[model samples]
Target: MEMALCNIKNPNELWSLESCDELEQYGITISVCTDIFSTTILWMEADNNDGDPSVFLNHFLDTVTRIGGCPQRLMVTPSRENEHIATTQTFLRRNHTDCYAGEDSVMGGVSLRSHMWIHTCTPWKICFADLRELGHFTGKDLDKNLIQFCFLHIIQDHLEEFVGRFNKNISDHNILRSQDDGPAEDKLQAVLPEDIEVCRRRCTPRGRYPCDETLFEYWELIRTENGWEVPVDRFTALKLYLHLRNVMETCIDEEEQVTCIDEEEQETCIDEEEQETCIDEEEQETCIDEEEQETCIDEEEQETCIDEEEQETCIDEEEQETCIDEEEQETCIDEEEQETCIDEEEQETCIDEEEQETCIDEEEQETCIDEEEQETCSDEEEQVTGLLQ
Candidate 1:
């Protein structure tokens, strides 16, 4: 996944192509320490290596193939790093390398999408195909997580190229609610200022990037068209707001249930009737959340129990040491009484050892749990509380 995102230079001149072909057999470690240098990383490493583009492309292809992902489908999203790669990538490729990158539609692609998305950051109509073929993927849990992460990626990509693919294939994206105008940019742009304002206002906090109640509210407001052939350009504002409100309520409810500290508790301040519109979805979400909270609580309890047990062990060790000290004191007294002439040096030596051992035990106890650690922990808790407040 890391390799997929990092841009590389020339896609040729990989050292292993001929060797892998020329020799049918290869060693175990040879395959393990595969040296397909990141084109991005190598570009920074001007200290060594040849300027071969062929080797670079081969390395790129090798990485993509290893990941079981298609090279053609791989495209760099709009980013400053990519802009750097755009002008300088070809130059860095050695003679043996060849960069098999796609056409440079990055800049324009990003700008248009950003403009169109300014109003509706997420568009659900694009997921029409995914909605149509939703039943094919049996693992609903995996699908749910994947869809969420994919939507996160889709929005984060900023480039419009993936929009087509997302509209066609990304299932479970029925959750995104985007508003697209008509064929004529002018026609689409003609949406009533009031209506567009309604949609844009529906997504507050500017970017609507926060994953709090605001996000839930935005997602919940997205509603399906009433008819078989859904309208593409318009949105059911009321329905969308209702969805957003539901999301906000659900987030609040789940957030409250798993609350470990009062500071982490999320407030469910949204009004009742407004949140009731999507009760079923919100309720189901609560059930899932409760189960997750139960698991988290159990894990936390286990850790707490382990810490308590460790403290108990420390306490027991201290008690045993104290008992040993009492026994030694008795022994020293018996020797002193029995041999009225017991050496003063011997008695002092024994007393000094006992005092040293007692001091050492006290130091160990201090190290285990003391005023310093408690003060630090208390200070951290106070700081966290202040932040939350």
Candidate 2:
């Protein structure tokens, strides 16, 4: 007897058979067989008492092919089992023909579609034509199921590589949640006002130049766009604070160097003034010594004149009045010399007082400069403290 089972024209229709026994009662033992690609299942008779099994199997496959199934989807079966209890165990067994034939084939593309339906709750739509254009699928006129399967496999491979290589613990849901939270810039601005103010003040007036507002702005852009939150973690916040503090310290150091240079210049000026004063004292001393020498020469000349008058008196023996007159002139010149010496001594004492006064003034100037520098240092320290806070 020859029989035809239901004249099924499509694999979809043939897959509706629930059990092999349904066909077995009619002397048709049906088996569920996967295509070479394992993309879909097809029905074939494993045993036919009155006909060749291969002829029926080939006819069934030809019908599938004519109905638009690709040969890659309906080629030699890897394994076969009765439809009712067929499992993955039967599919992987080495005894089956074509079990190792397509070993190097991309199975991910073939199995991805059905695997998604079984393992995932979400339905994803993919375009095979687009994938083909992108060079992901090289097969000409591929099926939708195969495309979906291939795209799913591509996603799986990418995710595996990303997780393994990048060590990212984030998921799609987390990304979606972050986006829903709104722009990060607004969040950053809301938390950074106080810190910005502090940094600005530290950079202004006290610093050599104004603080770079652009640094803060650039940081804000990066932080917001990269998904970093405001009021950042403790470690990152500390790092930022330290950076600002370092900038402030650099400004402080420059200012200090300037102040020190000014102080050094002032000290140098003071030393120059003292040197000029010493030179003046030396000049005055030389002038005084010259005046003393002139006075001594005058006294010696007066004494010689007195002695000449006495000798003339002795020689004349009657000129006593003239001799007394010369002696009185000599005494008057000596008194004038004594008065001039007293005046020079008084002038030297006055010069000494002036020099002491100049010394006091220099000391006071140095003290003032010291106080000013201390105040400047204190102000800079306070500014740094405020910035850190």
Candidate 3:
């Protein structure tokens, strides 16, 4: 039920699957069915030790596919060189039909970028915030740069196009390494393309680099000189935690919550529901054999009792729902009233401002008329006094 991760040092370390049957039957157990898909993923570093892993990868894919396993994500370590990365990218695009190019999907690739400040870092390039914070590369794992690159890239490649090319030089390299006194399986190294294509067409113009700084810091510590010394604390289920938190916030306020659906899981659920209906029919037939074909009084009485209980429960639920609905309506009315009150207050304020301006203008006009009348009367009096003299 859980996605198992082997927490060990070194990308060259041989990773194997344990449960084949149960995993393959996942579609049967899950109710949904249309979302299953296969992503032909290649994992391992080009520079991690001197071992060939092509045979192992081919075997892994074949085994998994045979048992009904479909890969949604193709997680891999960083490509050996820029050209190798480009060749791989191009190959995946031309050959791998489902190369993810969206910025918001979970089923695409996870690539490792070489540097932070470089522009040649593919438009879909996964860059690091600070090299010191990369916690997953430790001791021998430090040299396992490609593996670290893959993890970071996965987080970063939310929707970036990768450039890939074929390399002709490292073609004859052995796929497996030789341990002391024993020969072990080697890593898979591919022949990358010589020419690369920049994949800008599949990207968004405003897409930004990986943004979670805290996660980067924790991962950087995964590669310690003392060998990935991360604490083994109980980790919370990210979904349950996030969902509960979002619900509480939503209850008190209003905001959109983020969600995702695994296509495989959805398909499995649909399959399960169909299977359940078939099982229910078989169980009903078995019951008929034991109870006879007649509509017995006991069966009718039991059905009536169950129906009554359901009806009562429904009534109670309806009552509670009605109360809640009324409360929501009241809240809506209160909001509308508040908005209306504010509009009225704004209109009254404007009217008062206009009245103040009009009053000031009228007072100025009356004072001007009085001054003119006084000047005219004074001038007439002066002319009469001069004629009498």
Per-residue accuracy of model 1 over 1-389 as CA lDDT, tens digit each? 34432432212212111111110111000001111221111111110012133333333333333443222222333333233323222222212122343332111222212233323332443342233364422334322322332233333233233344444443222223212321211100111234323333222121233123443343434432222221222233223323434554577688876674444333343344446746967898899899899989999999999999999998999898888898988998888776765666678888999999999999988986787799899999999999999
Candidate RMSDs in Å, in order, are 46.1, 48.9, 42.4
- Against the unseen true structure, what C-alpha lDDT does each candidate score? 0.37, 0.41, 0.35
The 10 consecutive residues of candidate 2 with the worst lDDT sum are 183-192
> Which 10 consecutive residues of model 3 have the lowest summed lDDT?
23-32
lDDT of 2 by residue, 74-133 (tens): 222222321212121122121334332222111221222233222221222223234346
- Which pairs of residues have clashing backbones in candidate 2? none
List, in order, the clash count of every candidate structure.
Answer: 41, 0, 51
Cα error, residue 62 of model 3, in Å, equals 82
Overall local distance difference test of candidate 1: 0.37
Q: TM-scores of the models, in the given order?
A: 0.16, 0.20, 0.20
Error of 1 at 53 (Å): 42
Best by lDDT: 2
Write candidate 3's Cα lDDT for 74-126 as tens digits: 23333222222223333433433333322111222222222211333232122
